[model samples]
Target chain A: MITSILRPPPIIARMAFFAVLLGAWEWASRMGMVSRFIAPPPSEVVPAIGLLYHDNELVTRFLRTFGQVFAASGIGAALGMIIGWWLHHNKNAGRAFTDWFAAIAAAPLVLLFPLFLVLFGRNASTIIAMGAVAVLPPIILKTKEGLDHVPPVLINVGRTFNLTRWQHIRLIMMPASLPTIFTGLRLGLVFALINVVGVEYLIGFGGMGLMIAELGDRFEVAGMYAAILFVVLCSACFFWFTARLETWLLQTR
Target chain B: MAVANEMISRVTLYRVSAALFLLALWEAAGASGLFFKGVLPSTWFIGKSLIRLSGDPVFWGHFSVTLFEILAGFGIGSLVGVIVGLALGMNRYSGQIFEPVIEYLAATPKVVFLPILLILFGIGVGSKISLAALSCFFPMTLSLAAGVRGMNPMFLRVGQTLNLSLMQRVRMIYLPALVPPISTGLRLGFGIATVGALLSEIKLSNKGLGHAAMQAYARFDIPTMMAILIVIFALAGLGNMLIGSIIRLPGPNTRRLTKDRT
Candidate 1:
């Protein structure tokens, strides 16, 4: 399997594939084969990215959005962990509440942004609250699954060793569940980011989403594309960070 | 026994009471005049508005547009996802080649392409459909791929040893194997596709449920906005229920079969 993966494709071939696509896009746009308004070539978009960077609007907006996502996901993860652990100890209560919550969670929570804005106002708070709400369900569901699946023998051994309830949870339950909890956190963060951007786009505030909207309103298609590319970069960075963390955790174990 | 039954009833009453209490607090907060009236319309006004809005053709028109986009996108996405998933699962070479590309695109927010699509397709049905398709595509593909990959290799070997034709093997093995994953993908796709449609409408379109919601916000029509919210939430709940029922349908012992192999 390792050898097959190594022999699958070369970096150069991948680069070539991307380059050819870009080249064709540029050629098509310049030749008026496709409307420049619709498909602004990467040539225009690439340079526009530099301008956006120098303007500092992109950085500022990105930081604001990232801050909202981090704050919301952090709060949601902590709260979900507490709730999930509590529910683990009380199965019936957990089952009853989780069923109700999951029903609510499956709904389009983004539609509640207007209500959120009314309650919290058009500030980072509203955006953060929306993100947190969006993030909570996955964390709760995953953590509950993780805790439920902990090995019975491990719990028996812990009890035999005279470990207290707190000790059993901290030493056995938490460690056993960490990997799955982390998976939930990863999903939660992604949802949080998506919700924050959507909310920001819907109700205008200064963020990357707002920047995309502003550019679209102005018909500055290139700038809009650049802002989107920045969002993509942020997402890539998120995935990379989480993957590394997952690997590190596995290695530590 | 009578006392125990009475206590159970009391507990049920308490649960209902808690919900009502929360609603009352919301109503009280809105009526307090501490906040701007437009920002926090009274619950009384929202109830009235919901009734009023339900009868309006304009609301239905917008809802239909959003619904059409979601349904169209979901149908197309699920079909494509299942096909691609099956192809990749059956072919090791193609699967290895395309896996990274799929993963990369999956992680990227397809919403980022909204502006470009709007420019290309105009702020009409085309753009909305495109956005919904793009958003719904990834999760469907991912779920289907996971499902396909998860099929027991022993099953395939057994089919091969029996000298089963490729089409027969696919019919007997792959199609049944895909049922659960494809169902799950469809469920996830529905929600994401709805969001994609709404997002596109909110961002660019002039007509749709999202546009109605945006218009309400812009005009500070709080009750109308709340009405729209209730509608969206109801539709989402309905969609989820439909999918859940489909998943729970009695089926061949596929899960047990797969479990044995694993």
Candidate 2:
């Protein structure tokens, strides 16, 4: 077990690298080489963490944003999968739809936030809708690609065994498509998280984004940095978790 | 004359049908009064706003500034990404040392640094450009690195057997191998660049399409805001299609290299 842990790299080395960077940042700030207003030292940011923790408002706002992300991702993933599956049934239609859909996917859907706000008002629902809409195309595109790429030979084999359509899909297509579908889910989750934070930032709904905006407005650089750090940490955790999930899935298969 | 009339009639029918369907729905929603007046602006109001905004020089000025920032950031990011990616791919030690750092930074949403950037760059076009570059850099770097690394080892071996010059090998082998990945990265990078530029403008700027929309929002001018939003979306969609087509175009080097290999 110890060797397994050490096999990757020495944790000390990684920690040392982070420490050295932080040390340089602290030194630069103290030496007036870098503006503290622009990049407050970790010393300032660390203490401000306590202030944010004690602020119940901040915690509640974060929870609301989290709730929005979860709802949007859940709904978007379900709808995307269903649509993808439907498209998979018709090859030519799937291709044609994807041709147009890819353009939509590549467009920055955040531009639609105004329309969303107009339709849904300045509320949590709007945030959720924005996240869902932003992520749906990626999820749909990935899911369709996943389903379409399942080997034709496998389908032929299934048919040879006299399997029903549902059975063929469940037993073969799903398993074959799981990796690609997971990729879409990961992308969707990231987009959902981004849209939630972004909508909150722009519309002034309470969240980490709101906290950042509020701190910026107040010129509390340290507090803003702390909030930004929190967001970065959350995103980093999501990235790591999804990466591990992908690895595990690949291995299990 | 009859054939020409038939073609025109079909096209007109399609356009009118879509427009009528949209207008009818909007009119019905507006008449129902189930939602706030601001929530569902009348089609007539939005149409008028769109035409009015199209004639505004101030709007055009803001749009141009935003476009300049996006394009400049994309160019800078793509250059840096390609250079760094090439270096990392060519040097194993640097690749190992820096790959984790790059990945970590990439995973951390760059938007988190917006406040810091605003402070440093004074909420100007510089800040927007910086944000756009940061947003665009990751995908390009990742795709380029993958492209370089994914080159078939057999190609290298063949080049070695032929004792080809370093430059010749690069021109004949590496460049072709890198094209697909570089194209993909550029396409993704361009899209992210637009988003970054727009988001920065919305968050801090006094000008640009995003600012126009934000101003409309503040004043409860929903129709004007919608029009700006539509314009921004159309621009972003066009950029996406443009970059995507460039990437999808078959490179001359790719065909030549593949033929040589076969």
B43-89: candidate 1 lDDT, tens digit per residue:
78889999999899999999999899888877887778777877877
Q: Please name the candidate that would achieve the greatest TM-score relative to the true structure.
A: 1
Model 1 per-residue lDDT at B48: 96
Off by over 4 Å in 2: A1-16, A56-62, A90-93, A151-173, B1-32, B42-47, B153-177, B244-251, B257-262
lDDT tens digits, residue span A1-253, model 1: 9975546464544556678999999999999998777778999988988888786477788889999999999999999888787667765556446676677667777767778887888898999999999889888888888999999999899989999988988999999999999888988888898888877876778588888778877888777777887788787787778778878987898
Worst 10 residues of 1 chain A by lDDT: A4-13
True contacts kept of each: 0.44, 0.45
Provide the lowest-lDDT 10-residue window in model 1 chain B: B253-262
lDDT of 2 by residue, A2-30 (tens): 96564445455566678999999999999
What is candidate 2's CA lDDT for residue A29? 93
How much does each candidate deviate at the interface, measured as C-alpha RMSD after superposition?
A: 3.0, 4.3
